[model samples]
Target: MTAFLSRNLAARASMLASLIFLTACAALPRSGPNKPEIYDGAVERGGDAQVIFVNDHVTRASNFTPAYGFSNSFRNASAVGADEIRAGDVLGLSIWENVDDGLLTSLGASSSQLQQIQVDSGGYIFVPYAGRVRAAGSTPDQLRQVITTRLSEQTPDPQVTVTRVAGDGATVSVLGKVVGQGVYPIERPTRSLSAMLAKAGGVAIEPEIAVVTVKRGNSTGKVWLTDLYAGASNDIALRPGDIILVEEDQRSFTALGALGGQTRVPLGNEMISAIEAIAMVGGLNSNLADPTGVFVLRDEPEAVASKVLGKPVYGSQRMAYVLDLTRPNGLFLARDFYIRDGDTVYVTEAPMAQWRKRIGAVVGTIGSVNSVQNLAN
Candidate 1:
C-alpha cells in the first residue's frame, strides 16, 4: 500500500511539472525578444526603450511634419520674368529699311534681311549693321529697340524685330524614373514642378514610395510626391537648370508579433494612422493579442523624444510607444496617432490567452496518456 501511494505521488508530481512547462511556454510572447511589455499609466525609459502614451498631446510632436518638396520665395522667383533672354538662346532677327533700301537695295536682297543668330558667349548677338548688340538679360522687345537705335546711323529708318527661336539657355531637366526623360524648355508663362512633371509623362514609380528631388543651383531638397499633390503649397515652381527626379519610394515598416500577418508595409503618398497601419496588416490576432500592449517601435529623433516626453531622455536610439486599446478613449487615440517610416507595430500576447492555451495543451497531454494506459490494460 505504501509503494502504491508513492507511485501515485510521483505521477501527480510529473503531471504538475508538465503543466508548468506548458504554461511557461504559452505565457512567453510569440514575437520572441521584440515583444513589448504591458503599458500602465506611466512613462518608463530603460535601455533602448523610450515609451510614450498615445494621447491628444502627441499630435503636436514636431516630427509629425510630412516630408515633401517646398520652395521658398527665392526659388519661386525663377517662375517669374519668363520673357527675359539668357545666354545660349537662339534669336531670329529681322531688319527692314523704311526706304525700299540703301544698303540692302544695293545688294538686291529685298528691303529686309532675316538672320538666325545664336547669342555669343559674352551675351551679345552680332547684327549685320548694328555691330555687337546686347541680347542677354533683355526681353525680345527690349533687344529689338536696342538694335533699331544702334542701326539708326547706318540707315535713315531701320526697323528691327527680335523673336526667340529656341530657349536652350532657360530649360529644366526632368529625369530619373519619369515616363518621359528629357530637357523641357521654360517659356514666358512659368511652369510649376507639377506642370513639368505632367508634361514629362508623369512619374514612373508609385507615388507613395517615390521621392521628388529638386536640384536648383547648388541646393538640393526632396519631398514625397504625395505631399506635393496633397497640397498646392508643396508644388514649387521649376527653375532653369533645376533637375527633377522621381525615384522608387523605399520607405516601409515591419508588422510583427501578434499581428495577423508579419509583413513589410510601404508608406505611400498618404499619411497612415496607427489604426490604418494595423488594419493594413489584418489587425491583431484575436486569440493571442494583448489589447493593452499595442506598441509602435520607432527610431525617433532625440529632439522629438524630448518634446513628446517634456523632458530629456537618455540612452535610447529608438522609442517604444504603447497604446492601451482597452480604455474607452484608446481607440480614438490610436486613430489619431500617426506612424512613421521604419516603425514596427507589435501586439503582445494576452496573459489569459496564454493560460487558456496552456490549459488546453496540458489537458490534451493527459488525455493522450490515459488513452495509452487503456490500450496497455
Candidate 2:
C-alpha cells in the first residue's frame, strides 16, 4: 500500500509540475514582442500601426527617396558683382588736384587722403567738396566717377579714387561645422557657394554626410556638400547677408531586437539601404534572429503612406515594413530599399529560440520539484 501511495504521489507531482510550467509560459523573458504579436497589434485591426511587405511594387509606388539639390531660384541665381558697394561699407577715398590749394588739397600737398569714410544708412558718403554722394548702389569705379564729377565744378581737373575697405556689407556669415567660421567677404574668388565654403576652410564633417544651407534674405535652400561639387547648377551664387551653415547629416535609424547590437546608426552617406543599415548595427544575431521577420518601422508621411497603402491616409501614419530575407529576391529588395530618418529596424526571435527557453524553464522547475519531494520523503 505504501508503494502504491508513493507511485500516486509521484504522478500527482508530475501533473502539478506540468500545470506550473503551462502557467509560467506566458511570462517567458523575451527580447521583444514576437512576430504574431506584432501583426496582431497592426492598425488594420484597430491597432496603433500598420504592416506592409517590402517588395518591388511597394518600392516603386512609394516615393520617399530623399536627395539633396537646390531649387530653381537658388540654382539659377546670378552671381553678385564683387566690387559692388552696399550700405555699412567703409570707403578709402583719395583726391588729387592740379593746384596745391585745390578744393580737397592743402597749400603744400596736391593730393588729399580721406581714410575710413563710412557710408551712411541712406547709402550716401560725405566728401569734403562733393556733398553727400550716393555710394551704396555703385561700384568703386562708378563712385569715383561721381566724386570727380561733383568736385570738378569747384576745382578743375579733379582726380578721385574709391576703394572698398573692410566692412560688414557685401559679406556672407559662415557658421556651423566648418574648419573656419566667420563672416567672409564676397570677393571675385568667393562669389559662389562652393568658393565660399572653400574660403571658410571647407566643411569640418565628412563630405558624404555634410549638409550646406544658405539663407538669402527671406528665402532658404539646402544641398548636400557632395552634390554641390557634383554639378555646377548646385553651386549656387552667394549673396550679401547670406547665412551659410555646414552641418553633419542628422539622419539616423534605431536598430533593435535580435541584432548583434542595439543602437542608433547614422546615415554616413547620401543614401543607405536597409541591408546596409542592418550591417552597420553588426548584422543579425545568429542564435535568436528570425530572418523572415525583419521589420522597418516608421511614421511615414501622409503622401507616402497613401501611395503605399493605395488609400488616402491623413497626417503621419505609423507603418511597419516586413522584410523576409529568405525569399529569392529578398536581399536584392533590401539592397534597393532605402532607410529614412527616425526609422526603427527590428528583428524578431526565432521560434526555436523561444522553445529552447521554455524547455529550459520546465527542466529547471522539474529538477526543483524533484529535490523538494525527496526532502519531504
Candidate 3:
C-alpha cells in the first residue's frame, strides 16, 4: 500500500472510532441508576397479593374462591367436620323411669319434630334429650355414647332408640367468576372438593386460559382446581355446608398506543415486548406518534417488590423498568420486559400532538359558550 493512501484510510478510521466512542458515552448516561429490588409475593396474588380494599361491589369473598382463582384451603384454614350422615339421620331421645309411662307412650305417639332439637343456621342438627344428636355433628357411635350417658343419668338401666327421619342439609355453594355459580347440595357426605367443583360447572369455556383456585374463608390462599379434579377422589374430602368456588384465570393485558383507535390486547404469558405490544395495539401513527417517551406503567406497583423476594415487600427501590423506544435495536430489550396485569402502555403524544389537542379543547369550549349565549339572545 502507498503511504498517502494508508494515511487517508487511518484518518477515516480515527474519525469513525471517535464517533462510536461519543455515542457510547451518550448511552453510558451520567446519572446514577435506580437500585435493583425484589418482592416476596406470588404472581397469583393479583398476580401477587397486596390487597388494598376488598371490592364489596365488584368482588365478594366468594369471588376469591376456586370459582374465581381464590382457593379454599378451608381444610387447612379450618378443621373439616365428620362426614358420615345421610338422609335417614336418626336421633334417640328418652328419659329415666322418672319419665312417666304416659310420657313414654306420648313420645312413641307423637314422634315429635325431634326432642329439644335445635338446628343451627349452618344446618347442624342438635338434640338435647338423650343428648344423642346423630345429624347435628356426631357420628353414629358418638351419638350412642351420648345416649348411654343420658340413660345412665335418668335410669340405672335405660334403653335408647335411634332413627333418622330427615336427610342431611349440608351444602357446598359454588359462586363467582365461574360459568355456574350457585348452591350445590351434597348428599353422600363422602364427596371431595373435586366432586363439588364438578357439580359447580368445573370451569368456563375460555380459550388460551385454564386454571382453577379453591379459597378458604379463613385465609386468602388457594388450592389448584385441577389437582382437586385429577380424579374423583385425589384429595380434599368435603362435608355438608362447605363452600367451593371455581374461578377463571385473570392473566391478560391491553396495549393502548398511538393508532387510529385503541386496542384491547390479550396476553398468554408473563412477558411482552414494547414493539410487539405496540403492534398488537395496531402500531403507532407514524405521522404524529412520538416514540421517544413511550412509558409503560404496570398495575399494583406495590406488588413488584414482594414479587422479587417471593413475598409482598417494599418497592421503594424498584420504581419500574423504563425503556427508550427510539433506538433501532431497543426492541430486543422490550422482549425481556414483563407486562403485568392492570399495566398501562401509554404513548405520550408528540409536542405537536399535545398542542393540537389543547387547541381543539379551547376552541370547543369557546364554541360551546358562544352557542349558549346566541341561543339565550
Candidate 4:
C-alpha cells in the first residue's frame, strides 16, 4: 500500500535523524555531568563522528538575538499613565479626616462620618456626603482633590485622601519548580516583583536560568527567573494583573537504558539546543551508549504518518530537521528550535539491547520452571 511505504520511509528517516542526535552528542568529552565548561569553554570538533546516513536529510542554522535598539515584538516597552490599570484591579483608599473642634465630642481629629471611600465598578467612589466622585482613571492626588472639594460643602475644610488598596487583585500562578503551586497574594499595588516572589518562597535549586515565563491572555513574555535571583537580570519588575510563572526544572526528564540517570526532566523555557539538553541529563554512559544512535523520540509515530502522507508524492516533502550537532553551525540552529512545556528528548539504546533483555527474561523464566519441576519430582 502507498500508505505503508510512506510510514516505513518516515520511520527510517526519524531513526536516522536520531542517529544525528546520538552522533552529535557523543563528540564532547564524557568525563561526567556538570560539564558546563566543555560546551562553554570553546572546544574544537576535529574528530570524525559516525553519523548514520539515511534517506532523511535536513540541516539547521541560527544565532542569538542582537542587543540594543532591535525591536523584539515579544518584549514591549512598559506602559505609561492610566494605561497601566488593567481590569480586576483593587485600589487602596486612605482618608485623612480634619475634624472640626465643635463636632468633636472632646475627641481630637474625628471623622465626620466614615474615613475611607471604596471605589466601585465604574471607577467612582462615594464618600459620606461627597456622593459618586470619579476616581478610577483619576490619579491618587487628583482623586484626593476631588474628595476634599466635595466635602468642603459640609465642613469649612474637609481633609480627604485616596490611594490604591494594597493586595486586592489577581495573583500569579507559580508552576513547575516551586514549593507551593497556586496564585500568590500581592498586597501592595506598587511593590517590586521580587517582593511578590518572596511572599511565595522563592525558586527551587539550580532552577533553569533564563527559563521563567510570564503568560496571560494573548501576551507571553520570557524572563530568566534564575538570573533574577542571581542579580543578572534588569527586566524584573512585575506589572499589575501579571502572572509570574516559574518553569519546570531540567532534572525531571527520563534517560533510558544507557544513560547514567534515566529520569524525566522538567521542561523550562531556556533557549537550549539538543546537545545542551543531553549534557543537562548526566551525559551518556559511554560503556553502554552507542554514539551513532542517540535518538530523541519527541514525536509519536501517528503524527509523523500524517506529515509523510501530507507531503506531495511528486516533490520533496520537508520531513524534519536533524542537525549534525558536532558542527559549530548546528548549535546555532538548535537555539532557534525552542522547546515548549512537556517535550520529551530520548536517547535510544543500542540495536541488540532489547533482544538481549528479552532473551534473558525468557531464559530466567524457563530456569525457574525447571527448578520447580525438579523440586516436585
Please name the candidate that would achieve the greatest TM-score relative to the true structure. 2
Ranking by lDDT: 2, 1, 3, 4
Q: Go through the candidates in order and give each one's C-alpha lDDT.
A: 0.75, 0.87, 0.48, 0.47
**What lDDT tens digits, residue by residue, belong to model 1 across residues 118-146?**
88768888877778888999999999999
lDDT of 3 by residue, 116-142 (tens): 343444434554444423345565566
| Residue 172 Cα positional deviation in candidate 2, in Å, after optimal superposition | 1.2
Tens digits of lDDT, candidate 4, 200-281? 6766645554256665556776556655555524344454456666654443334444566666665454455556666777
Q: Which ranges in model 2 have alpha carbons more than 4 Å from their true place?
A: 1-23, 370-377
- Sliding window of 10 residues with minimal summed lDDT for model 1: 33-42
Each model's backbone clash number: 6, 1, 43, 17
TM-score of candidate 3 to 2 decimals:
0.48
Model 1 residue 271 distance off true place after TM-score fit, in angstroms:
3.0
Candidate 3's displacement at residue 83, Å, is 3.1
Measured on C-alpha atoms, candidate 1 has an lDDT of 0.75
lDDT for model 2 comes to 0.87
Q: Write the per-residue lDDT of candidate 2 for residues 136-216, one digit (tens) a residue.
A: 889999999998998999999898888996467778999999999999888889999999999899888879888999998
